[model samples]
Target: MHYNLRHYRAEAERHSHADFHQIIISDVGKLELEVEGRAGEVCGRRMAFVEAGRSHAFRAEGLNRFLVLDVNIDLAHKTGIEALWQSRGRASAYLELQNGAQGSLLGLLDRRWFRSDASEFTGDGMPFTNAIGDPGLVDQIRLILGHSRQAVGTEKKTGSDIPTRLVRVMDWAETRLTEDIAISDMARIAAQSESTLFAAFQRYLGTSPMRWLTAKRLQMAWFLLQDCQIQLSIGDLANAVGFSDQSAFSRAFSRQFGRTPITVRRDARKLLGAKL
Candidate 1:
């Protein structure tokens, strides 16, 4: 399984997920997890996991510095790396290793490749030697995983007034064009009903939720294309802006900007007089 680090800070409260398992480790501030039908608090040196398909929400009390992993389960299973998950379940306490150390461990356990050559082992074999490792630290992390699973959770809604809620929702929407955000989910984040959110958005932004989301996505796509270091193809650009298909991105770009992405990239270069 491959993973990317996604940082989040919820001024209010929100739920986040992709199509994979998520492991969140908090190193600063506090967050309350609202998972299933229960609620629990996690703070410094704490870790939590939200399994794929579970409905979980979190709120950062103030500032929150954390690391999140979206794991590829199928790949893990195919490669016999599921032992990491099993170890975690058997361990009953959360693990808090230094960032650099944890990064090393995660790279070894979660992927088919490792930065250090000695970390590789084939088949069901154990590749690591105990000489340079601490068995106690490993045991602690696994315990944390089990403890987190046992700690069920829910948090009270933010309960901001309608207008205030709508404003925050709009701000969040503008920032997350690449996310598979849903209207119902947005409504929940805003502490409003679907109808209330719809009416407020139309009144405030002069657009429906999806239309506004599409426009934001296009704007983000345009910005990314204008970045000189970005060498992604149209399909890459499309996926970056939340359109899973290149054709959809092309059509939407043409409709909104009156040109294809290639033309837009060209025009941006011409405007900036950038040599490529």
Candidate 2:
């Protein structure tokens, strides 16, 4: 179940189905609301959630800006959407924001609106901003929530592209080579089954993920050793990139590039010596 905002006008907002729930907040002007066979009412700076099969029409007399969060309750529940949801599609959810959080959420929704309209941004994969609230906005939200609940956990990856996701996972692993990069975590980012991802990597990049990961580690180690400021022993660079033993790193490096890490570093030093 996707949650997004759709804006429409009086004449544009014609008779429609009541199968979805709408959370609407008028930011400006006025709107005349009517539930089928009922007296119409004017809505201003008001928010309401109208449920499915409930006949309703909204007509704004003048230019107005508002947010309409349309959600499918059944689908949302089935998908385990952890985001905040108002009472079972009956109450108008007017989120009273503290410390400018409301404005940020509005901005985020507006950006999604832009992306939804523009071909350059629209796609099948979920938009990155939608899954993880805007980083700056999320941080503030966390600060506000912190006072109300238990401590929040560390930041989680909110990215969803395959290649970009792979790069992000690898970058994190590069920093924490001492720890294993969970296969499950990588699978989540790739948005594919483990077998599918393996096949896709071989098809696209012509290498297995783990092999690619090892290559990246060796590359990082090589760079670290070549840097003049780095004064660590060969073993230090190996361990920094997840290799607990220098011999193992050397063997892997030699297998891939036909040269040991020490020789590579020595060769780099020679090049530097000649340049000086």
Candidate 3:
């Protein structure tokens, strides 16, 4: 398992994890989540679950505080909670853990497993060592797993081939963000016709292939600017991410994020300095 404390502004793309199941609990502010074809907002006492191999995306409103758990599928299976893993391919892609159980589980994860300052932790091959040794923690895990299984069973399953194809195309596109990717290329990668690919993107992601690619490239640039340890000029960064001109990249970045690239870098450095 991996634990993280996140403060996100917005994530404007539909993305997914290939393996680990994700459980996110909101501590402050609301999270807009879209999984499969369902959409919702999670806040207060609600928690969202995205099973392994499912397509999901979320963006925070403002100053969101949340805890994320990326639990390995193998660990769930080994713990005799294979139902959670099995539910991945089903149409019930998004599940919620609500009310008192949500609070209790968040408390357990926060107090026992997480550090506020640390963004992530890996189990180092030992999954839930403390939970396995303690009966109370074991019960808590069981309770959480039981709710997951119940949620999976309660939702009606729908059949859709477009999402699977879209996921395949997205996986291919993410790796080649800096390259000139065309709709035909995406279609070839997904084994669908260009028209079919366009329809899939429109129906599932609410955008065209090129528009989605642009958003992804911009998001990548935003992260690269915030990494102060990486020594790269703005022009180099722009060229590296497929933008041919620094001025064009700056304009695009400001339009998307409402802040200049220079401002973002400056603010990130200030934040880092404060942390130091």
Candidate 4:
């Protein structure tokens, strides 16, 4: 039941945790959310529950802070948290907080819940075990999340420091991403043999260097499309991000962001209308 404060940039992201469920409540601006095939936005006291191990993605604009809690599945039933789920791990829920639910959740926002005191609610003294005995705080959780057909639901922090050598490669890739760069170029930049570079990338980033570069190129293209001022034509934009064929670039961009360049730019225009 440890809580965390997270900030998501406007850039789109897609990933998942295999061992824990995630509860996200927006504290500031809206967060575009797509979890396990359903899509919604979290804001205005709205919250979402993403069951353990489901693939999800999110994006946001302007300033935003989200209150995040990572829940262990085993603790769910034990803590009486599963009262909200409609169908266990396969289905997720999104709802607006009601009653004193918002207050109950926000009360736990004290920074101490995230640090050493995190253990204050586990084991025989388990938050759930204790919660069942006293029933005050856990009851509040059930009240808020148990709404029919609605609403929502930290942990072993994953990932390690990106190896220092790979950092050099990434920095070099960003500046020349528009240029025709290859794995050899990246390996040379890091002064590592191609095989070694491959190992490091697979071990750290879970992808090959060239694939990572292509993703980076597409991400850059996406950023450009979001900006109101960068008005390059689709073909020119494709070449600018190192894609030789405009059609191929469009397909890749669509695959990455689920929207064609034309569509993203059009949406950006609508959003930027007031600012411009």
Which candidate's lDDT is highest? 4
Worst 10 residues of 4 by lDDT: 122-131
TM-score, one value per model: 0.44, 0.39, 0.43, 0.42
Predicted structure 1, TM vs. truth:
0.44
Residue-level lDDT tens digits of model 3 in 27-95: 556777778866766554445667778787667766666666666777656665446434532445445
Question: Candidate 3 lDDT (Cα, whole model)?
Answer: 0.62
The Cα local distance difference test for each model comes to 0.53, 0.48, 0.62, 0.64
User: Which stretches of model 1 miss by more than 4 angstroms?
Assistant: 1-162, 270-276
Cα displacement (angstroms), candidate 4, residue 59, comes to 1.1
Residue-wise C-alpha lDDT for candidate 1, range 1-276, written one tens digit per residue? 333222345643545445656566543346666656545655433456566666776666554444444555564344332355555534322333321122212322222122334443221133242312333323323433323233222332323553767756755454345557899988987898999888887887788888877887786667656643345578866875678899988999999988899998877778777553
For residues 1-276, what per-residue lDDT tens digits would candidate 2 score against the true structure? Answer: 223333345572545445545545444444555555442332321234455677776666555545444445554344322133332212322222222122223333444234544322211123222322333333222222221211112222233545655544444333334445666655765677788767766866689878866776776565555654345578866765667788998999899789888888888889889989
Mind giving the per-residue lDDT tens digits that candidate 4 earns over 155-269?
Answer: 1112268876786677546545556777888899789999999999998989999888888788767765675554468997687677889999999999988999999999999
Give the residue spans of candidate 4 off by over 4 A. 87-92, 99-101, 110-140, 146-276
Q: Distance from true position, residue 189, model 3, in Å?
A: 0.5
lDDT of 2 at 259: 87
